[model samples]
Target chain A: MTKVSIHVTLKEGVLDPQGKAIENSLNTLGYDGVHDVRVGKLIEMFIDHDDVEAQVKVMCDKLLANPVIENFTYEIEEGVAQ
Target chain B: MTKVSIHVTLKEGVLDPQGKAIENSLNTLGYDGVHDVRVGKLIEMFIDHDDVEAQVKVMCDKLLANPVIENFTYEIEEGVAQ
Candidate 1:
C-alpha cells in the first residue's frame, strides 16, 4: 500500500473566518506576531499501489476538495504503509 | 516575515468520524482500494521573524492544537511573505 497526503487550502481572496478567529485568539494569548492565519485540511490515506497519483487526483476532484473555492495538492509516499 | 505551516493530526487510536465518512464515500464512488483515511488540519500563517520556532510551539500548545488527542508538526520557511 501507498500513503497519500493531501493538503487542501482556500484560494486567494476567499474569506476565512476560522483563520481570522485563530489569529485573534493567538494575539489575545500574547503571541502577537501571528498574522494572516489560514486554516486548511490535511488528509492522509492508505491505498493499494496502482496509479497512485491519478487515483488520488480524481479522489480530490470528486470528493476530497471543492474546486470552486479550494485548491489541493497531494504527495504520494510509495510503499510507506504500515 | 516567515511562513509557518503546521499539520495537526489525530493521535493513533483516536476515532475520526470525518475520515471514515470520506472513506465510505470514496468506496461508494468506486475507489475501492482506499482505506484508513485520516483527516486533519493544515494551518499556514505569517509571523514576524524572531524565535519563530519557539513562538510557534507556544502557539500550538496554547491555542492551535489540543495535545490531548492531536499531534502537530510544523515547518518554517524564512522570508517567504508576499
Candidate 2:
C-alpha cells in the first residue's frame, strides 16, 4: 500500500472567517504574538497502486479538496500492511 | 514573524467516521487499492515572537487541538513581513 498525505489550504485572496476567528480567540486568550491564522484539512490515505502520486492528485482534484478556493499538495510514501 | 504549521491527528483507538467514509467512497469510486484513511486538521499561523515554537504548542494544547483524542505536531519557519 502507498501512504498519501494531502494538505489543503485556502487560496490567496479567499476570505477565511474561521481563520479570523482563531486569530481573535488567540488574542483574547492573551497570545499576543499571534498575527494571523489559517485553518485547513489534512487527509491521509492508504492505497495500493503503481502510480499513487498521480492517483492521489486525482482524488484531491475530484473530491478531497474544493478547487475554487482551495489548493492541495500531497506527499507519497511506500508501505504495505503487515 | 514566524510561520507555524500545526498538524493534528486523531489518536490511535479513536473512531474516525469521516476517514471510514472516505475509504468507502474511494472503493466505491473504483479505487479498489485503498485500504484505510485518516483525516486530520492543518493549521497555519503567523506569529511575532522569539519563542514561536513554544507558543504554538501552548496554542495547540489550549485551543488549536484537543489533546484527549488528538495529537498535534508543528513546524516553525522564520520570516519577517516586508
Candidate 3:
C-alpha cells in the first residue's frame, strides 16, 4: 500500500478565526514572542492504487479540503501502513 | 521568527470515526483501492522566541494537542514566516 500525507491549510488573505484565537491564547499564556498561528488538518491514507498522486488530488479536491479558501499539499510513500 | 509545524494524530487503538467516514466516502467515489484513512491536525506557528522547542512543547501540552488520545510531533525552522 501507498501512504499519503496530506496537509490542508487556509489560503493567504483568508480570515482565520481559529488561528487568530490560538495566537492570542499563546501570547496570553506567556509566549510573548508568538507572532502568528495557523491551524489546519493532516490526513494520512493508505491506498492500493497505482496512481497515488492523481487519486490524492481527487480526494483533496472532492472532500478533504475546501478549494474555495484552502490549499492542500501531499507526499506519497510506498509500502507503508496507516 | 521561527516557524513550527506540528502534527497531532490519534494513537493506535483509539476510535477514528472521521477517518473511517472519509475512507468510506473515498471508496464510494470510486477510489476502491483506498485501504484506510487517518485524519489529524496540522498547526503552523510563527514565534519570535529563541527556545522554540520548549515553547512548542508547552503549547501542545496546554492547548494544541490532547495527550490522552493523540500524539504530536513538531519541526522547527528558523527565520520563517507564518
Q: TM-score per model for chain B alone?
A: 0.97, 0.92, 0.93
Quick one: best lDDT, which candidate?
1
Residue pairs in clash, model 3:
none
What DockQ does model 2 achieve? 0.84
Query: For candidate 3, what is the TM-score?
Result: 0.94
Per-residue lDDT of B1-82 in model 2, one digit per residue for the tens? 8788889999988999999998898888888887768899888888987777779878899998898999999987779562
Q: List per-prediction Cα lDDT, in the order shown.
A: 0.93, 0.87, 0.88
DockQ of each: 0.86, 0.84, 0.84
Candidate 1 vs 2: which has more TM-score: 1
Worst 10 residues of 3 chain B by lDDT: B73-82
What is the per-residue lDDT of model 3 for residues A1-82, given as tens digits with 9 covering 90 to 100? Answer: 8888999999988988998998898888888788768889999878887788888898899989999999999998877854
What order do you get sorting by lDDT, best first? 1, 3, 2
Native interface contacts kept by each candidate, as a fraction: 0.86, 0.85, 0.89
lDDT of 1 by residue, B1-82 (tens): 8999999999999999999999999999999999999999999999985799999898889888899999999999989946
Give residue B82's error in model 2 in angstroms.
5.9
Candidate 3 Cα outliers beyond 4 Å, as residue runs:
none
